[model samples]
Target: MIAGVGLCAAAAAATPDSANAVVNIYRAELADGSVRFASQRLDPGYVLYLPGERVAATSDRTRAGTSAAQAVLEPDVLRLAHRHGVDSVLVLAVIEVESRFRAQALSPKGAFGPMQLMPDTARRYGIAERAGPVQNIDAGIRYLKDLLARHEGNEALALASYNAGSGAVLRHGQRIPPYRETLLYVAAVLARAQVIRNLGQP
Candidate 1:
């Protein structure tokens, strides 16, 4: 009976957002696979973070590239990302890192489209075979939701899962892998997202 009580206490301590000190208000996991107590928030409608690639700082130019991903689809992707609290800044950063806004970009690993989603993963998110910027982004967000759930709403663990695959994360049990490429990818996107958070877009 004593052992059961102690185990329950331990589980509660490992949950995300213990005291809500973190400003972001989103859940994240640590590198050791333990659930984080911090919270982060995602604001998808923040137009700056979702701005188009190559868009100028000026008002007129901003709208030039804005339509690249299709205005209609942009809102849906942003809405879903926000609803999932996945951080729109993170999404934009990933898009920049993965395809640089090139919807047709293809990687050797068979990742295709703007978000560079794998074929099997894309199918899971209902993404079509053809490359569509909005669809790709939407599917990427869906995949993120699944990863976040796997990590108990922990964003960092989910992110690592995205880069390394859920199987890898499962094998490690929420801990970040020692793989260099995956490490670099997560760090790069985080840094970029931080910049967006700080700068409020150009």
Candidate 2:
């Protein structure tokens, strides 16, 4: 099980109305094809993606652990990144730095999932289910694609926007913010991406 009981409680406390209540706990498939429970406070502007047709049955979670799951996840993330017109290496780097491929990872700042998506960021991308690995990864990459477009294909500025808010980047004259966290995030992602590319993970 994922460590989400606490998150569910936090979300339930945040919204009292059943209609608008945040889902604190939910089940989603992990990269290893196992279902795990997760919890996070749902941000406004996101609604569930209820498919019209019934979906096929999901896979059981393999006990082979993180490495096996990551092996599955990397190619999936790379495919999604390509579909979104973003570099697969960049997405891989972000995943490494953000949550180290842990689909259920959550930050103290309330960023949740492998891509460490802030609540507002997830909402903006229409990610109804933040706990699911595939949904979360797709949402993050879609956001990254938009950021890249906004920054005229400049990876550094795009990464800065991803770390800090785009508003912050614009306020700083459309440059990477000087904040230490954002700067380090940009550098680390770039460096890691170079390493991945060097190893021919493309």
Q: List the residue pairs that clash in candidate 1.
A: 17-37, 24-40, 24-41, 25-39, 25-40, 25-41, 26-39, 26-40
**Per-residue alpha-carbon lDDT of candidate 1 for residues 53-156, written as tens digits (9 for 90 to 100):** 22224433233334454444456556768876676766776765565566676766678776778898888887777857777888888787777777887756
What TM-score does each of the candidates earn? 0.61, 0.66
lDDT (Cα, tens digit) per residue for candidate 2, span 8-62: 2323222112211222233344454333232332343222211112223224422
Which of the numbered candidates is closest to the native, going by highest TM-score? Answer: 2
Alpha-carbon runs more than 4 Å astray in model 1: 1-77, 83-85
Could you say which candidate leads in lDDT? 2
| Colliding residue pairs in candidate 2 | 8-24, 34-61
The number of clashing residue pairs in model 2 is: 2
Candidate 2's C-alpha runs over 4 A off are 1-66
Give candidate 1's whole-model lDDT: 0.53
